[model samples]
Each structure stands twice: as structure tokens, then as C-alpha cells.
Target: MLKYQQIALEIEKHIEENELQQGDKLPVLETLMAQFNVSKSTITKSLDLLEKKGVVFQVRGSGIFVRRHKRRGYVSLLSNQGFKKDLKDFHVTSKVIEMDVRKPTQEAADNLNIGLHDDVYFIKRVRYVNGQTLCLEESFYNKSIITYLNNEIVSESIFHYIKEALGLKVGFSDMYLHVDKLNQEEAAYLGLKEGAPKLTVETIFHLTNGQPFDFSKVTYNYEQSQFFIQANNELL
Candidate 1:
């Protein structure tokens, strides 16, 4: 699975480098096989994945060509259970970009309420909805809280692991939404042009014991997604 993902990424890189363009035909399977040094099955699987993502389209008796995708729909962050539970129409998937314990940036340290010297598990993932890239999320977890995190755990739901494996009860989370511009890393992962406008959500999660254990920032492709918020009347 990981190998196929790497091949898909390399194909995306080719598109980014202008080696491919919208409506431009793709190279033959043999060409791709030699280019990536992979088997025929691997190349076919890679193209199939890209096709599902609306990155390329196939023609009967003809070659594959790039397709300009018009990504649509909305994903909710209104619940603490995560987007998968909240989304009704989309099948969500995650690609783990990196996972390692590292010194926290000042912003991450402050949000997770940890000291500068404290090391945290930094996890980065690119999330997709029915094959269309939606967002890139970077999460910082207190090592003392989720001490067993790895790439495999990240490919699944971290919230699930926190509650089920670690036996931690989530109390509440504070979320701040903002309109931001994409940075280079985010732009590349989401396949967006540099400095594209995005909707960003920053969240801090706390345990029942009042310990803040997780801090995450998720950036969404604004054109492909929307956010809905509900407000109820309360006595002041």
C-alpha cells in the first residue's frame, strides 16, 4: 500500500513539474515502469489510484490524459469524534506523511501547554475524501499521554487509539477557525497553487483530568470544502 502511495506521489510530482498538464496524455505503461523501476502491476495500480483521484482520465482505445478536477462538498469539524464520523457523503482516507518525536516549535509548545525542552510526537497527514485531497493536518501529542504512536497508528484514527488503547477520556476541545494562505509544504501536499487561500482550524484537546494532551492544526482546501456551524440560544 505504501509503495503504491509513493508511486502516486511521484506521478503528482511530475504534474507539478509541468512534465504533465491538463488534457495531456500520459506516457505508456512500459515507460512508467522503466521510469519508476517498478513492475507492470505497480504502474497500473498507481495510474488507477490517480484516476480515482480525478487526476487523470482514461479513454477507450486511447491513452490516459490529465483531467482538471472540480473538487466539491463540505466536511465538518463541529464534533470531537473527528471528520470521518461527521461526514455523511464522503469516504475519508488518510496518508501518513511523517511521524517522529521532535522538539516542539514555540507555537506547538504553547498550544499543548508543554515546555520548550519537552519532546512531543509530531504527526503529519494528508487527508482525502473519496480520493480528492482535502487537507493536511499536523498534530502534536504529549509524549506522556500517547507514548506509543507510530506511522501505522496515524494511518488509522488517533482519537480511536487515545480512547481505546490508552484508556484516556476526552473531556473537551477548543477550536479556532481562520482564513489563511498556504505555505509551500501545504501547497504541495494538497496539490494547490502556492499561497492559495485555505480554511484553517487550530484545536487543543484536554483530558477529563484537565490535562491538555493534543494540539493540531488542519488546513483545508477552501474551494473543495466548506464548514457549517450551529449556534443555540443561551441565557447570558
Candidate 2:
């Protein structure tokens, strides 16, 4: 008796081993049945699981193909955590360019709770996952706390250091998202053209004590990114 779970596991194993890419079709029902000795019902269940998990997509009349990987960075209320509940799930990398530390303007001072005359640490970075450019992030932090940011800080997730090293685990945040055209500087880092479609996110992360920790603006190239939001009835 071939169970659906067994079929699903086999399919999972196949995906990891094969360079099956988006648009690459998997073995059809007959091929799967012949090799796995599974019934049509079980195979159907397996395919359904893959579709729901975003691993495969079904085209009308065209059998299933590997689902193109999408990097979904939206609804990231706690991206301080990671992409998929596990830290490794995020898998994104970054290249940081340190910006000059200077007196913050009125807008910067207000956002980061600093005085207009106070110095602020500004860093720019392009974020990637799986070797693909996904985001361009400009971050501002209170220079009084963060004297400077270097390459080491840029390559890794900033939340990791703030929480584990500096003990600045954020307890809350406010985020707004929108679509916009990429400006010249932003387009350059992200390998996008000026006026390219991009996702813009303005985020304010707060410390557990209700103090602002950081303010950042992140722009994502839609072609290289995908977003996720899970709904739990109980949580709602």
C-alpha cells in the first residue's frame, strides 16, 4: 500500500537532487506510477502537496513543472526572525557600502529619535539570495549607539547582531509597502534600470523597551523577489 506521504517524500528528494528548474517538467503520472508503484490517487495527492508548497506549478494541459523560485519578502512583520521560521530559510546575502556619517537632517533625526545635529550611521547594501539581487536597502541608525558599520556587519543579517550581541531584540515594528520606480543609485546596485518596477518598504524597528532601534528603506526588484503571508485562523 503506497501512501501519499511516501510519494511526497520521493518527490521532495527528486527536487533537491535534480537541477529541475522553473519550466522543467517532472515525470508524468505514468512515469511516476511505474517507478514508485504508487496508485494514481496517491500521486495526485503528492502533486497537490507540491503545488500548495510552491514547489511546482500546473499549466493547463501541460503537466507539472518545477515552480519558479520566488523570494517573498513581504508581510515580514518579524523578518528579524528569518524567511521560513528557520534562520537558514532566508538564505539571502548582502554587500554593504558604508555611507558617510554626518549630521542627520530633520527627517532623519525625527525618524531615529536623534537630534538634527547628531551624527547618524548610514549604510547602503544590495541584498541577494541564491545569487540573485532581491533588495536594495538603505539603513539609518543612531550614531550614538552604532559608531559605524563595516563589511562584516553588512554580509550578515543585522537583526542577528543586534539581538545576539547588542541585546537589542526588537519587540515591535511598523512597516509600509508600495511599488515605485527605481532611482539611479538604487537601480545601479540592484542591476535594475532607472524607472524599473520595485517594491519599497519603509520600516521602523523598535526595541523591546519601546525605543526606536533602526529605520530603513528597502527597495526590492519584483523580478527577483517574492513575498509570503500565512494566515492562521486561530491567530486571527
Best by lDDT: 1
* lDDT of model 2 at position 195: 94
Every candidate's lDDT? 0.82, 0.73
lDDT of 2 by residue, 1-236 (tens): 24876778778778867757778888888898888887898788888777765667777787988864444344343355644342245566777766667777676678778788888778788777767787888888877766556678657766777766776557788888898788898888888899989889888777777777578888987786666653333346
Candidate 1 per-residue lDDT, tens place, 1-236, comes to: 37877998788778857856578988878888998999989888888777765577777678878864333344445566667854646788999988999988999899888998898999999998888888899999999788889778899889999999999999888899899788898889999988999888999999998888999999998766875543322311
Q: In model 2, which residue pairs have backbone atoms overlapping below 3 Å?
A: 71-226, 72-226, 72-227
Give the C-alpha miss distance for residue 192 in model 1, angstroms: 0.9
Task: Report the poorest 10 consecutive residues by lDDT, candidate 2.
Answer: 69-78
| Cα error, candidate 2, residue 65 (Å) | 30
Candidate 1 lDDT: 0.82
